[model samples]
Target: MHWRQKVDYWLETLGDEDPLKIDLLKNLSNEKLMEDSFYKDLAFGTGGIRSVMGPGSNRLNVYTVRKSALGLAQYILDQDDDAKTRGVVIAYDSRHLSQEFALEAAKTIGRQGVQVYLFDELRPTPLLSFAVRHLNAYAGIIITASHNPPAYNGIKMYGQDGAQLPPAAVDSMVGYLEQIESELLIEAADEKQLKKSGLLRYIGEKVDLAYIQALRTIQLDKKAQPKDLYIVFTALHGTATKPVKKAFSALGFNDVIFVKEQSFPDGNFSTVKSPNPEDAAAFDMAIQYGKESNSDILLATDPDADRLGVAVKNDLNEYVLLTGNQMGAILIQYMLEQKKLAGNLPEDGCIIKTIVTTELASAIATNYGIKTIDTLTGFKFIAEKINEFKQFNSHTFLFGYEESYGFLIGDFVRDKDAIQAAVFISEAAAYYKNQGKSLYKILTGLFEKFGYYKEETRSIMLEGKNGAEQIERIMTSFRDEPPGTINSIPVIKIEDYFKRESLDTVTGEKAEINLPKSDVLKYKLEDGSSICIRPSGTEPKCKFYFAVKGKTAESANERLSELVKAVFNSTCDLALHSI
Candidate 1:
């Protein structure tokens, strides 16, 4: 069908119920709106689905949410009988129409006679991960866009193990989702009817208490209480301020300040460019508050509170923001060194990180005599490793993190938990302060010990459908013919994860990489430098990650700078190699 025909079909089917659809139908004579709405279904990547809020096939609304839920219900029902009874747990973050979307999914799944446990109000994404296991639900759904702007929203699906659904499961779910022609004509039972039938339950408080208590158990140094290590925190206008503050107070951190302007659940995220902790702008309010309080540290969480961003006072007493890689490296070093000192370090424990994250974490893990496992991007892969360890009883999960400010210290919640991270960070700060050392000093000490491993990331966003195709082309170009050298450093090895193949440039030998297929490429340099290229799972962008090492921080910075320049210089020339 032509795009216009699809637009008319959408108008005829949904115009009556959705005001946005009605307004859009009225403007159908305009070509741009029709093209925008009917160009295609919103792209569902490995991160489930996210899109602008509108009344079209390409947007997220009541219709799209129901259709997706119905498809998930079909997939789950086909999986097993236990899956049918176990149903799904649903949670939402503080976003426009988030609550409505969560309930819509419940109703759609309920139409299939599947049970649901819905949170009474907004909660963090990690809570939903915990609820899935606590209730033994077959799957879970979290209605949040993470740190996206107000005009956008999303739906993330979790598997039975309380992690984001794996690739195979997502592929199967997408196969069924494609067959959904319209929203399910769901017949929902009232709360009373659902309760009487024992298929629907509302949960709160109990789960919150359990989650908080679990976070408390991972403290590295419980006795190192510092009296005056004043700290400032901000939630970036999302769902974490209250819980994070409570976690700090519970940990006995006496001087904590909240960024009042960005503390509440403001959908606009009015104070910053975006709510992503990866961006320095997200910490503006917290930084200001830190300066006022003479705080030793500053912390900020993204919308759903899964990712944490931190800042600390430097030698000149100026607040210096740390990248996710920097934070993860510091945390790992602190945890391992302290655990060994306390005589509690596990003999058979392991740390986990994504392939594209900084190498400093792996180096730190190696120094602690703990093995590090590298998974593909996304916390689901990290959670999958955690689950694998639990099933076999092979190794204990010490920590899991990504370069995007997502970190998990304990296994209480399968996904990243800033609430947990905040607690550990506070404890670590207190530990160092007790010894008359600042976190800043401790970080420099690690750089000295770890050989100054520095890394950086750059994302190039390509918007809309054409951008998507271009990204595919870009990846294909690199896979077929990778550069022989980067910045005059000979390429020693290349790993093409999509084909599960690794090649030795020097020997012309190839070997199978024992991992699931993913569209990512990594190149190792002769100088112990590396570069990784992968498409962003949640956004319309492709990412390039650069890692370099040197004897000193200044040399590491220069080496990293040369590597980044080489990658950018080859971008256009490399794309031309695609067929």
Candidate 2:
């Protein structure tokens, strides 16, 4: 159907009581806006649907939420007999309509006679993953946009293992979603009716208490983590405020300061320009709080609280934000050290990171007598590795991370847990302080031991359908007309994940990659630097990852700049900047 026809159909079918129906009528004259809204169905790919909240088939609303839940319910019923009674857990963050969307999903699933475990209030995404396993639910859903602007909201679907749905599962669910025609026509059972029928149950503190009990096992240091170390934390007006407070209080951290302005569950995220912890701007309030309180470290979690951002005080007494790569390297060394000291460092243990992450982490792992494994980008892949190792009893999954700030240390939660990361970093800060060294100094020490590694991630925003096509063309160009050299540096090897093959440019040899196919390209330079390019799975953007290593910090930073500029000059004429 044409985009205009889809808009007209929505206008015809939706009830007047619906807010989106009213919005459609009010904006009938705005063709550009209408075109963008009705151009296509909101994609249920890479977990679930995420988009601007509005009155179109392409936007996120009550109807889309119901439609997506309907798909999950049918998939559960059809895929496994046990999944029917196993039920699904529903949770939401602090975004606008998050709670409403959660309820919509619960009602939709309950209407299908599937039990639904809905949280009583907003919670972090990681908790939703834990609640699924805790309740033995068939699947989980979280209403959040995870660091996106206030105008957007999304649904992330999780499998029974508490990880995001793998591609095969996502494909099965999409088949069901595609069979449904009109989003406005999908039906949801009445909330009161579902509650009366015993298909709807509210879950809160019971699960929270269980999760906290599990958190106790994640503590690395059994002894005093330090009474003198101070911390400043900000939830960025999301769901982590209460949990973080509870975590710090439980960990015996009395010197911690929560950033008051950004600590509450404000959906708008009023105190910051962006909710993403990767953005240094989001740490402004936390830094102010840190300096005022003379804190040792500053931590910020995104809206959903699955990814963590950390800043440490340097000798200059200024709070410096650590990139995802930097923090990942720091955590690898710290966790392994504590485990070794405790005499529980598994010989078969292995740390996992995405191929785009820095090699410094691998070096750190080697220093501690552990091996590192690389997977395709995204935490779901890491989660898959966790499951694979447990099933085969091959390797102990110590930790997993991606350069985008997502990390997981314990298998208690299948996905990344910012709460766990915050606790772990706090312990590291105290351990270092006892030795009269700052966290920044420890990071520098790692640089000296291993090599100085620097990394930068940049994205080019491409919106709308046309932008998506452009992204595809750009990716295709790289695969077809490959760059033999970047900045006069020889491209010694190319790993094309989509083809599931790696090529040695000099030797003219190829090797198979034993991982799922993906639209990613990794180019290895002769100088030991690497570059990776992939389209963002969740957003209409293409991301570029650059990494460089040197004996000194100055050399690493300089080479990094030259490589980034050279990559752009040597390839497509696309603008890229640090996101």
On TM-score, the leading prediction is 2
lDDT of 1 at 127: 88
Which of the numbered candidates is closest to the native, going by highest lDDT?
Answer: 2
- TM-score computed on alpha carbons, candidate 2: 0.97
Worst 10 residues of 2 by lDDT: 570-579
Clashes of each: 0, 0
Structural similarity to truth (TM-score) of each candidate: 0.95, 0.97
lDDT of 2: 0.89
